[model samples]
Target chain A: MATSTALSTTEAQRRRARRLTGEVLASWLFLLPAGLLLLAFVFYPLFYLLYVSLLHWNLIGRARFVGLANYSSLLQSVYFWQAVWNTVWMTAGTLVITLPLAFFTAQFVHLELNRRLSGLYRSAAFAPYVFPLVASGVVWNLMLQKQGIANWALSLLHLAGPHWLSQGVWPLVSIILVTTWQFFGYYTVIFLSGLQGVPPTLYEAAAIDGASAWTRLTRITLPMISPTLFFATVILVLQGFQTFTQAYVMTSGGPNGATTTLVYYLYQEAFQFFNIGRAGAVSVMLLILLVAITLVQFWLSRRWVNYDQL
Target chain B: MVNSIEPLRHVLSVPPHFLPLHPEVGPYAGAWNSAPFGLFYLNTLFMASAIVLGQLVTSTLAAYALTWLRIPGRQAVFFLILIGLMVPEQLTVVPVFLEMRTLGWINSYQGLIVPFLGSAFGIFLLRQSFLQIPLPLIEAAKVDGASRLQILTRVILPNSKSALITLAILNFIWHYNDFFWPLIITNTNHYRTLAVGLSMFFQSGSGLTPWNQLMAADVFIAVPLFLLFFLGQRYLVQGVMTSGIK
Candidate 1:
């Protein structure tokens, strides 16, 4: 009887081991489809991008391998540096307009209104976000024409509106304006929802302590919403770096290349000019910029992003 | 302000009118009939639907595995997946374009749809949602002798319905709005989506564009997306809030 029992115990142990293997296999099967797709597309292309950046191929036969020559040419090009400068200023301009406007708008909508009114206002504000950038950009192009309503509105204010779609600062400023108009509502919704999550009891406690309105805002509200703020800032900057459709439809990288961001420059190089090697170098530079900025933001986020709420 | 359609002399008057006093569909008809707008709509619908469906199934399964399965190298895999978020899509487009050509998928629906089938954002969001489901609930399901798939469908998915819908709608609308991939992949208008097609229609008249017709085209292109935004606003808001805060 004792020997029979011991044999049964060993059989159970073997069965358990097989079952463990089955579970692990099941888990892998679940992940396999997604893993393959991401590996092939998202992950593989990154390394390929790095590799292609080192090649000197147009849309022709035999991509001749070149080392750092493409990058050197880009570094020396006036047009490339101009694009880099334009992209930087455009990002800074858009963020400056976007974040403050969104925050204030959210505060007004959430704090100064009843529930019904806020809902109506939120939908109205976010409606612009739904439009395709190319389509609205078309409208803006027409509206900024010499006889357009944008100037007519400026006439109503007794201030002349500059030729918005023209070269120099106007084109860059126009792109920023349109981008801000389209996207501020998105950030506003994020901020509004973040604001909603803040417990009212904390506000009441501050009120009881005779805290100034600014004090309540600075001390309680901003700290509580820092995670959302950090998320928004990071997302916005990443998006700003990739501003393309607006520049594409509105200006076509322009009369003097005034509004050419990195992406527009890359597109022009790849498709129009067929400068594949140069485009690859631009892509590599963009990749480095994105990865570096992302890493720095994440590292810096630890300082101020209040996750103690979590 | 052009008050009406295609009376260009009146439409391009010094000051634009607020109301469409002489409301007519002349420009709308012109815009609609001008291009293969209907085909463009159909292409976008099909493409966006395929992407949404593929992403949902793959992301849900992957999120579940990452959350519950005691697999080796899981952390490294997760980190690698998260790297997808850091790299911009534009940076990878060239290589992806080359790969698509090599696969003979250029100008095909597969070219448009395949590269975007797996979304890292969807996986991350769903994983976060699944983690929010109480472990005790999953434990109870397992104790009842439920198989892994059964437990996922019965316990985890039922609880993550909102997150699932959010992922679906977001992916759908985003792909619908997408122009870059389609512009690169499709050399012909046969498989072109609306955004690119619309831009082509606009540029069809390179020097002298019909402003009224262009506005009409813009209106039609925008209305469908506006409808979608309204339908998905609540869940979209919830998804964004959850993704950011936690």
Candidate 2:
């Protein structure tokens, strides 16, 4: 009887082991499709991109491993530096214009009297964000034409609009304006949500303290919404770096490469010139730059982004 | 200043007789007849649908495993998947293009659809929702002899309607408006999506693109998303908020 019981226990243990193995197998099976795809496409491509960045190969020719030659040449290129500068300027310019505008619009829309009107304003504002980039670029192209509505509107103020898309510096400004217009509503919505989360009692208490509106805004609202502001700045900067369609369509990265941002330069390198190696180098630089920026932003957010509520 | 602007406003206003649209030659008709936008629309619909469906299935399965399965090294696997989120598509464009060329998928629907099928964001979103499901409920389902797949479809999914819808809508809008991948993958009008097609249409026929027709095409391309935003603005806002906070 003792031996039989021992045998049965061992049998049960074996059965349990089999079931456990089956469960693990099933779990892996579930993860396999996503895992394989991500490995093949997203993760593997990163390593492959690094490898390709070292090679001098057009699509047709056999890849000749050139080590860091591509990187060195790109670093030496005037166009590459110009593109980097343009990207930085665009990000800074757009952030400066967009953040304040979005904050104010969000504040206005968040007001009690404007509550009913908020939906209308939000939809109208966000309408531009949904338009395909190419389409918006096209519309902006038309709007920024010398004889277009924008210049006509400016002429109403007796300010002659400079050639918006055709001139050198004006194209950069035009690209920034178009990008800001495309993104302002998105940031506004983000800020509006943040604003809504700010407790009304704080504002009421400030009012009872006889605090001025400006003082209340500076002391209370800004601090309360600094987290959102930080979030918007990170996203806007990222979007600014990814500016391609506007420059591609509205300006074609020209009036002499004035509007050429990093991605545009990368595209020009890879597709236009078929210099895959140099484009890969640009891609690596852009990736490192963005990731570094994002990390630094996160680190810096500790100083200013208030997380007291949560 | 107000009095001076009134006359100018009248002059700037579109003339009452000047119609933006005519009876026979509407902007919609003009744009539609001018380009193969119909083909572009169809291709975009097919590609978007394929991407959304594939992402939904893959994300759901992966999230389910990560949440409920008693698998070893699950955290490591989750982190491995999350790494995809950090690597931007722009960074991978050249290598992916080469991969597509090697796989003979260039200008093919698979090229556009497959690489995007497994979204890290989708999986992350779904996992968050799945993790919120009460453990006791899942245990009860198991006691009733419900298989993992059965519990997933019957219990976990039905409870996650909002999350699933959010994923679906977000994926649809994103892929629908995506330009970069489609631009590189497809060389011809055959597989061109609306974004790429519109761009090519604008850039081609060198002298000048017809502004009115292009704007009309833009309106057409944007209408679906506009309708979606108006109808489901709450879900989109919720998704964005969740992403931001998380």
Candidate 3:
């Protein structure tokens, strides 16, 4: 009886081992396509980008190895510094206008407006976000012209409108305005969803405790939605660094390169001047900057972003 | 209600001469005559559809493996996908372009479509949805001697319809509106997507590019996406909310 039991136990162990191997094989079979594509397209290119950053090539001759030359030259270039400054300004400008307006609009939609009307408002606001950036840039380009509707509206207000897409500061501002218009609705919807997640009983309790509406909002609503707010900020910053199509379409990074954001500079370097090495360097720098910003945001979120209730 | 009706009343009171049919002449005609927008539309449609289909297949299968399959190093694979999320396309664009050039894929459909087939976002979203499926159901299927493929197709997929639709719609819109990749990959009119085609058209002209025709072209490029967003607002919004929170 003991020998028979020993044989059965060994057989069971073997079956279990085979089943485990089968599971691993099946899992790999499922993951193979995605894994291969991601590695080939995404991961492999990342390492290749780093390598290309160290080489001097223009898609023509031999890619001669140059250590730190691309990086040093990029750092020294006035145009690169200008691009960085423009990108920071554009990002800061958009975030300032977009976040506040979106929050207030979301609040109004969630709290003040009737339900049916709020749907209309949300759709109307989000309509602009659906338009392709190229299309939005074209429409806004026309509107921001010297004699366009924007100036016409300013004229009605008895104020002179600047040359929006023509001059230095105005071009950056025009890009910011178009960006804010394009994305305001998206952030508002995000905020709206965040707002809906806040428990109503908290407000009721605050009211019963004789808390003012302002105090209640500061104490309750803001804390509850901080996570979403943080997420939006991270998204905004990442996207801000990638501001290309608008500048590319509307300003063409022109008027003395006032609106030449980082990605635009990268594009110009690689495609326009065929400075492939410098472009790779710029890409690596941008990646570092983005990753650093994201890491910083993640670190900071612990202090400000409320996850207690969630 | 009164405020809304006031505008309608004012419009009704305007003279017949105020509102004219065919007010803008030759804008659409001029835009159509200038570019082969029909070709652009076909190219955009084909590319977007191909990407959506590929993403659906890859993401669903990968998500299934990550969620349900018993495998070693599952966390490591998930982490790899998360890495893909952090590395934006801009960071990889230069090398990707060079790689495409090396493969002679520049100005081709494969250049546009293949890189985007494996979407980390889609995998992440579907995995989250897949994780919500009760374990008992899967166990029951296993006990009934059902194969993993059958369980995934007949059980898991049938239950993940909303998530699958959401993924498809979002992917379609993203690829349809994508300008940067198509712009870099395709230089010729024959291969250009609508967004890239429109930009090229706008840039090709010198001064005094016709404003009305440009606007008409912009409308033509934007309308389909606008319609999709309106129709699928729920799924889009839900997708955003899901991603934002978790």
lDDT of 1: 0.85
Model 3 C-alpha lDDT per residue in residues B1-246, reported as the tens digit of each score: 111112222312212223433354457777878999999999999999999999999999999999999869899989989888878888899999999999999999999999999888889999999999999999999999999999999899999999999988888987898888998999888889999988888888887666667777887787889889889988877787788521
Clashes of each: 2, 0, 0
- What TM-score, to 2 decimals, does candidate 1 have? 0.95
- Alpha-carbon RMSD, candidate 2: 4.2
Task: Give the distance in Å from residue B216's predicted Cα in candidate 2 to where it truly belongs.
Answer: 2.0
What value does the TM-score of chain B take for model 2?
A: 0.89
DockQ for model 2? 0.49
lDDT of 2 at A257: 83
- Candidate 2 per-residue C-alpha lDDT over A3-25 given as tens digits, one digit per residue, 9 for 90 to 100: 99999999999999998998899
- RMSD in Å for model 1: 2.1
Q: What's the true lDDT of residue A73 in model 2? A: 96
lDDT per residue (tens digit) for residues A1-310 in model 1: 9999999999999998898899889889999989999988988988888788888888676898999999998999999999999998999999999998999899889899999999888888777766788887888888887778888889889988888888459999989989999899888988998899899999999999999999988999999989878888988988999989899888887859999999999988887887777787898899888878888999999998899883
Indicate the fraction of true inter-chain contacts that candidate 1 also forms.
0.66
Tell me what TM-score chain B of candidate 3 gets against the true chain B: 0.89
Deviation in Å, model 2, residue B13 alpha carbon: 11
| Model 3 Cα lDDT, one tens digit per residue, A1-310 | 9999999999999999999899989999999999899998999999999999999998898899999999999899999999999999999999999999999999989999998898878788877776789988887886787867788778778898899988759999999999999999989989998999999999989989999989988999999999889989999888889999999999999889999999999999999999888899999999989988899999999999999984
